[model samples]
Target: MVDHKQYTYRVIWSEDDGEFVALCAEFPSLSFLAPEQSAALEGLVDLVRDVVADMAANGETVPAPLTGKRYSGKFQVRVPPEQHRSLAIKAAEQGISLNRLVSSMLSV
Candidate 1:
């Protein structure tokens, strides 16, 4: 049976080419390039699995998902309308939701 433990990936957009890129960040050499977004992502997943199997045979560490406590918190903050608008625009530019942007900033 094929081992499903192998393969991990993250999808990111390439600003210069206006295309989506799937990066196996843990195994830099494992990547895929395709003109279509879905194909590129699917190819990346396959490549990552192959790379992981090779690494396993070589006795290298297989990539594993992080396991940690999930954060659950909620609060409300008051900001001026103009500032809120600016924050929303900045978050959109970074391709993240406003809550994520604020949470990251607050974490640091």
Candidate 2:
């Protein structure tokens, strides 16, 4: 059984609902809201547990928690030729590689 707690979760105050809203990154379509932050998170966790159980019982593939995945720290992004050139120039001016420049910008 997948641990429900392994999924990424966030709780934020919802201005429109006037409550704390709980969200799970793995299950974007599911949410729970409550007057208290704890309740909101607990409710969402319970919901995810139930859904995961249902999915498993029906022989469906459950999403792996992001935390359980391995990343190579490398990804490709496509940019227009002009923008690429501009970035390359900036990197040259800063005495850094184009990849370093882009990585710094993205980190900001």
Candidate 3:
């Protein structure tokens, strides 16, 4: 089982709440709201650790952390012919490979 600390956590400021909110992507149901980003992150991580420990005591399956996951860096996408042609033409005009164009688009 992956450690709770290995899970991906993000502390983001909430405009409406006027505070920092910490969220663990692996455990979407859990969040911590705090005045500061550090406190929010710490609260969220502590909750995650407790949750993981409780899950272990109950013999429940724990979620795998995203940090240690590996990606193949390759995937296949199918688009309509017109869209494909347009992308090819755009890539050609930009003087970049179609793969690079698509990668740039997705990154943005």
Q: Say which prediction, candidate 2 or candidate 3, comes out ahead on lDDT.
A: 2
Q: Rank by lDDT, descending? A: 2, 3, 1
Model with the higher lDDT, candidate 1 or 2: 2
Candidate whose lDDT is highest: 2
lDDT of each: 0.73, 0.97, 0.95
Each candidate's TM vs. the true structure? 0.48, 0.97, 0.85
How many clashing residue pairs are found in candidate 3? Answer: 0
Q: Which stretches of candidate 1 lie over 4 Å from their true place?
A: 1-8, 67-104
Per-residue lDDT of model 2, residues 15-55, tens digit only: 99999999999999999999999999999999999999999
Q: Which stretches of candidate 2 lie above 4 Å from their native place?
A: none
Per-residue lDDT of candidate 3, residues 36-92 (tens digit): 999999999999999999999999999998877899999999999999999999999
